[model samples]
Target: MPNWLLPEFIADVLPSEARKMEDLRRKILDEFRSYGYELVIPPMLEYLESLLTGVGQDTEIYTFKLIDQLSGRTMGIRADMTTQVARIDAHLLNRNTVTRLCYAGSILHTRPSGLQATREPLQIGAEIFGYPGIEADAEIQSLALASLKAAGISGVCLDLSHVGVLKALIASDPLAQIFEAQLFDLLETKDMPGLIELTKGFHEDTRTALLALPSMYGDVEILKEAKKILPDTEGIAKALAELEYLAGQAECDRVTIDLADMHGYHYHSGVMFAAYVPGLPNAIARGGRYDHVAEAFGRSRPATGFSMDLRELARVLPAAEKRHVILAPWSDDEKLCRKIGELRQSGEIVVYELPNSRSEHDEFVCDRFLVQEADNGDWILKTAGNE
Candidate 1:
């Protein structure tokens, strides 16, 4: 029971990684601000019912719960920040005009999101409230692209999917009566054999649509193929059109479509997107339209946004530029203190030396130092190498 021992998938961020993550957070939030997205900081936990509402059942297993000492009710440690953001928009702010909000903080999950993933993740995200048009979705996508580029992420392949298409395909009375759980498994895993067997008793079009989904991945033209293969009911056509519009608006080098992509199908009401970089097995970021996520909060608004794990991004991102540092000697001389203050005012990183301690480290390469010149009796600065 060593005190320093953290649970599996939860580890402390040492100085090096912490600095990089903070830099990423600062730069990304600045990018979000430039797009007029106001920053919001939600609490780390909430009542279970409040936290789980409209976030989709798939996320429930990831949330950790405990009895609240104050209220004597079950409270959930947030596994995702998006639901909190939605509640803020609908209940707290209650604004009629479209609102763009962004947030960055840590979320604790009960299970790892992926292989070798951490249960404690620093999540950064943005959300748009009150706008249902494709334009809002486009803005969010463009912002995501810009933020990724700011973080030096390149060679990204943006994968687009619309949950509406799936909903439309299976909305028929006969198809609705079938075992949805089996179909979900087949579609999610792309189990063609199981899908074919399961769809044997389905209608001709339904069977054809279910079987065609797995192969629907690839290129922007997948939308055209989907329109022909999948039924147009339940807003499928509108959904495809929106995806196509976003593809054009995104202006990324590579954009692909997939009709079978159902990662957030349960609560993701419209177009869903995930950004993938070459060689990465999972998407670097993901988001989409979830219109009624705020319904339980008393207002149903059109919302679209994206969130990425800052810890994950820091791993993939290039190191941030460290400030040029000047290591000053451990002295209480008035002239020395004045010089250090002046340098700091001029945007210089002058680390005042501590008693019996080293000021320079791997990141803080002591480029310059302060010294007392015996000849003139005044403290002067000198290069570390020269000294």
Candidate 2:
């Protein structure tokens, strides 16, 4: 392989896309800050045990692990930062009141998540720790929408789900609990045939509710249909009610519900949500309640948050506008050097044209150039075309 060639599902971010990603990161972080979320920077790697605790346990397959040279222990590059932030809250901060935290960083996955997905994703998100109310979940969903809006992505649809729904259905039947793992897979994939084959021995009501879950996706009305058709267990009722309240509270172009969405079944404790835009088939942002994560760190705290890949978010946006700048000739002349320094200090991009060479930039346009006035030798700005 060529030394310059990157591995599959990994590639360089060129100037144009890099600028877009940076600008989006700043705007989204600013939005989080405005919501009173303090920024936190977690390390990229940690002891394997620390990285795979609680909500992060499901990400072990995605993490890249290595043997620590000095300690002779295994260390893994984080595939997700949610649990790390939880560690920070549980061990480092250890405050009694509600705490809000936000982070932006690169996470390494052993493999790509999808056909077009990258192995290295720039993850940006916010989390609220030490609050157990449903309002925290609602706030997280709202902040996710706000972050996307800050990135200028509109026509967004918020899809809500709760693990409690399926958990309730399974818990009510001994047979369902026996085959819980299989049932989870079948439900998530919406395999009607597989579900029929697997649920034959289950109680008639449990089977019916399990089968109905796959089709229980639509607008808020689906929640009503779910309450009517599914088993009338307390767990199911609570989950449905929470979904209803959140659906009603959601502010977006559209709202959707998927009772069988088991994406974060192992990680999330209660309400879970994914946000989608028009052009993307997959969700652009995903978040939910994972109140149990902090427990693995020896402190039990209610936590909720959401995160998105900055690279993927940047792809949906148009190329960043090329920066307008002033072109200047490189010289030892004291006055010209002073003028260049002044322009740079004032936040202007000034590219010096080298002797016998041309300067080129992919993300900058020299729309203006400094010219020496013939009368007094003073440097003055002139439009490139006019000159």
Candidate 3:
């Protein structure tokens, strides 16, 4: 066999892990359904152009592309489900009104340089299109919180920031263009000292506000503190007000406002947020308002959405013992086979095996075992541990 069996970042989801992931996926989908967000099973592969329409070129580099022989056009595997749903909403659904769509699928991407982010990630999320307001942001955040609760995650911190606020702060000074890149880098790394050093050239007030940005995290109180420090730019004020309003509306107990949290995705316009749980260094789920993504696709609709990485959630979930029942027939009885088939059809995990050697009927390597009687009678069921 050739040495190269699989690529570096991608790997198989074996039966055990796959089963657990499917269970988590179903639970999340059920939660989304409860919220009236209709499920959408988008195609695994799409046209390269359609997929690359809204999301920037940096994200596009991660996609795996190929030429379609039948259509003689470039096709690419979906690297993100958000853009795919946007295309569906704009072109397929074609409604100017509000729509809630949810999806669960695998998104393929190349491994980032010096990072171990999985190449194939299982994403489950919802998109809200055509809603325009901070109210929409609050609703999405609420839904995301509820979804996490439903998945049995507790003590979640909702890290909220406004993309517009950050952009406005950068736009205020003539030197903004020169310092924008470094400022973004500082925010990404949560480096307060580096930010303080970099902003030394700015006025004292602006410099102090910029320095304090990284630590402006906590409840609604932090929002007030941010307002006091940040220059009274109209955009920044609006963004702060929106965050405060969102905090009031959100019912979650653990909310943190990180004014400096800036993730560089072009689609995120208004507010961006991520859900963090214990044991996971990065966010288990993230989403924000991207009103312009639909417009980039030529439909010009406002949209906001978030996705939970199933793999990350699985890592944090407590190990659940699998329940199994085994079926063993001493004789090749047709009726026994029929019964086993019925149980299997009813969603029971049954394993049919040859008759056991022990006198005990359930002496088998499973949670439970079944045996057929020589006489025409009901089958005997026994717990494996008891036997």
TM-scores for every candidate against the unseen true structure: 0.95, 0.97, 0.87
In terms of TM-score, which candidate is strongest?
A: 2
Model 3 C-alpha lDDT per residue in residues 216-330, reported as the tens digit of each score = 8777798878877888888998999888887777666577787878774455888988888877787878999988777767898888989988877877887656565575655
Tally clashes: model 1. Answer: 0
Which is superior by lDDT, 1 or 3?
A: 1
Candidate with the larger TM-score of 1 and 3 = 1
Q: Please rank every candidate by TM-score, starting with the best.
A: 2, 1, 3
Question: CA lDDT of 193 in candidate 3?
Answer: 78
Poorest 10 consecutive residues of model 2 by lDDT?
Answer: 49-58
> Per-residue CA lDDT of candidate 2, range 1-387, in tens?
789998989989998899899999999999999999999999998998999899533599899999999999999999999989999999999999999999999999998876588999999999999888888988998899989988999898999999999889888899999999899889889999999999998999999999999999999999989999998889889999999999988889999999989998988999999998876666789999998887878999999999999988987888888999999988888889999999999999999998999987889999999989889988989998896
lDDT of each candidate versus the true structure: 0.86, 0.91, 0.79
User: Relative to the unseen true structure, what is the C-alpha lDDT of residue 96 in candidate 3, on a scale of 0 to 100?
Assistant: 78
lDDT accuracy of residue 317 in candidate 3: 80
CA displacement after TM-score superposition, residue 137 of candidate 3 (Å): 1.5
Clashing pairs in 1: none
Question: How many steric overlaps are in each model, in order?
Answer: 0, 0, 0
Residue-level error in angstroms, candidate 2, position 288:
0.2
Q: Residues 156-263, candidate 1: write the lDDT tens digits.
A: 889999888767767773764467767877898999999888888788887888899899998888888888888766587798899889888776779999888889
Better of 2 and 3 by TM-score: 2
